[model samples]
Target: MPDAASTRAAPTASTASSTTLAIGFEGSANKISVGVARADGTILANPRETYVTPPGTGFLPRETAKHHRDVVVELARRALEEAKASMRDVDAVCFTRGPGMGAPLTTAAACARTLALLFDKPLVGVNHCVAHIEMGRLVTGARDPVVLYASGGNTQVIAYNERRYRIFGETIDIAVGNMLDRFARVCGLSNDPAPGYNIEQEAKKGTKFIEGPYGVKGMDVNLSGILTFYETYAKEHLGAGEVTVADLCMSMQETVFSMLVEITERAMAHTNAKDVLIVGGVGCNLRLQEMMAIMASERGGKLYGLDEDGRMDDRFCIDNGAMIAYTGLLQYENGETTPLEKTWCTQRFRTDEVLVTWRSEAVKRPASCEPPTV
Candidate 1:
């Protein structure tokens, strides 16, 4: 893996402006994403490819690492090509450095370091969770909002405080997506190309609710019982008539999203933040968004769902490199860039490590003109 400390001497002002490109890499879980974005948070190109690990499998660090090594270059090349740029045009490379599988994280870091060295560019390390929040902020322009992040690896309610992003509530066990995926597999839904998508589609046809675990206690969550119950029910009752998959899907979505809504509402109340932003892959669920909107509206708060682009923009919902690149640019502008010697990867990094609000004194110059970097 690449060492985060090696710094390329600061480029001349002209060179910096001419080649100021931000590349974001996300190689966590099953997806390997690479995106290029401009300093103004405009996404140049977002390209990602998903890898499928076997079902009922826990985190296999070594296997994931190998997957990254095999696909990072291809994904990066595709992203650059889509952006209509080359290595020479890039000034900085940003990658998800931690809070993920060590093997995959190292693989991505190694590739990023090699590219930085080859192109003589600065390397920026980013937190995956922060990238999700930054994406919401950039897309929706929500400032100082309560963030609800629900994904395969994380489920938390976060608020910005004293320059850092703090977690007020989170899952005590598996993530919401993880639970869904596991349940899907148990229900024999993994045979579909996209099990989650399939489940969502089936859930739309479901009008009845079956008994399932409802373990929402305060701001914290417990999903193990729900998952276990689903597993046993699927085993014993899958062959029974009138037990449609749609009912199961509907029940699961309602139960989990209701829990999420409760926690997000509590976070908003606790923080006194009127703006509530939902992020992470699970944020794409329309039912979840509807519930959140209703909850926020009832509390006399506004809910920003980041749907300006479209109602079903899968590109933005899933983890992407563009979010990481844009976030790195924000940190860089704010003088939050960590020294090469002090930068390190953390598999369990808390979002509080990086300050939430960073102001950049650097003035924006025309694309044709050079801007000074301080």
Candidate 2:
């Protein structure tokens, strides 16, 4: 966990072709990543590894930390090599600072600090949620869009305002990804690649629509009760062939994603926003993207969830180091750095806590003049 403060002295400006380069580390959960990026939002190299547990189990903090420590150094070397750059080319070191598991966050923070001190470069601590939003905006060419931020430990509808990415709506209980993972364990789904991916594949084959809890409490959503009901129903009906796992998966996805879309649409309407941007691990879901695209089109707006190549690229969509590096590059250009003494990690960091001083004021667009689709 690193401090999200700007109290440190600025490093010498890099005159390397008028663009600054940065290396970033990310081990917030089971994923460990290292990436290099330029201040102009160009990703030089981004590589990551995931620490997955076997079926019927979830990853724990201690083992996940060990995995990160074992592979992070190698990944960093690979990233720098892929970028065809050395320590001299890197202007700053950045890492995910908080709102994640403590042990994993510590591993990334320690790696980032070592790199920064060894190279005598500035250190920047980036917010994981903010990194996602910044990367989404950069890649999609979407300006001032309402963001739907969804992941394993977080669920929120966010929009940039004043000097912060404000959280307009969020989950009151468990994140949608967490609920899906827990249900996957109960159904004995494989975690080799990811539980959510397996569930999504199974859901595609499903046809029956089983009734489940729709937990929408005003602008917030509650998914814990829905997970409980699905777990109990599976135990009673799965063994008797009364319901299939695919049906349960499909039904649960529909129920929960509907809740997300509902809140995100409300945020868009409240803000009069014409574009919607989806960012997070769960944003990789094609079904979710389709649903969001439909909602955006119906409102005479566009959805910014796909890459420039017109598909979900996991390197930017999932938790990766490039997002951290790119965001840190932005902050550094704005004359912000985290002091060495304050570069400690925390697990309770909030999304709205960071001060985003890089961007100008958000511009509102007329509904008839929406930006071209990405």
Candidate 3:
């Protein structure tokens, strides 16, 4: 738990040319990342720490928050040192406000409030999903692209609609990343780096595709069924040599990633947008990137993510405080600062809940790609 302290008026950003610096804190889940970013889209520093649970265990909320509390001060110091900037240079402080583990989100929020008061800087509460999209656009030069946000706790196909990042599709149950992590545990894979990464490695050697229950209900997906069926199949067939971990990994990824890409393509079609940005923890998957690239090229568009250059790594793609900082800069510059009394984190913030005040201009829709209205 973070110690609470508070109060101050945030500095206002009057123009785009103003070189405002922001320090961000993120502990939405098992990973806690501290980072600094400039309004000009420059990443000053991004230092992170991830909690690794045992092979068959999941990361508990309280434990993860404890981890964040133990390392936040040290991480913040290191991030500032790497960026060659001091707290005095920061104009605002940002932290993940939600769509994450409750305890962890609160831990980061409390820390952010403390820092904001200490430095007399503006405090900004950033939605985790919007942070991912803003960071993707900042890192890759994508202009108003349809976003596919995939992570441990969230899976949403989003696009700008009516002044908001509308969620055209999302998971009805557990997220695809959670599905993969659970599967990895079932297969006795290591969760050291990330279960998803290890599962991708196993998927690469797959010789067969054991078809599991594929869930694609219109725009929404249900990954819970996939995990259930796959677990049962593994238990029933692994000892009999009928199925292997490789096949299961490949099958699960192929099935779920295809659903994610499909929903993203639908969003693109609906919005007539040509660029698609893949973000979040699970977006680092190479197989998903390949499928998405193929789909985008066929539609005369391009996919803007995955580790090809830097999308797959922790620096830009994975969960990080930099994403929060970068996004908070946009909001703070747009006058979206949070009051200390109202600086609370949520565990269920939706992508569409964000008003997206910064991106005011609408993207031009292609005539040929106009969505078919009912």
lDDT of each structure?
0.73, 0.85, 0.82
Candidate with more favorable, higher TM-score: 1 or 2:
2
TM-scores of all predicted structures: 0.85, 0.92, 0.92
Which runs in model 2 stand beyond 4 Å of their true positions? 1-18, 307-310, 362-374
lDDT of 3: 0.82
Q: Which stretches of candidate 3 lie over 4 Å from their true place?
A: 1-14, 306-314, 365-374
lDDT of candidate 2 over 263-334, digit per residue (tens): 999988887887899898999888898889889999999997564655665657788888898888888888
180: Cα error in model 1, Å: 0.5
User: What lDDT score is found at residue 73 in candidate 1?
Assistant: 92
- Backbone clash count for every predicted candidate, in the order shown: 3, 4, 2
Model 3 over residues 80-189: C-alpha lDDT tens digits? 88878898999999999998999999988888888888889889999999999888777766767888888888888887655678788899998888889999999999
Candidate 2 residue pairs in clash (backbone atoms < 3 Å): 1-344, 1-345, 1-346, 2-344
Ranking by TM-score: 2, 3, 1
Q: Please give the range of 10 consecutive residues that has the lowest summed lDDT in model 1.
A: 1-10
Q: Candidate 1: which pairs clash? A: 5-340, 99-347, 163-356
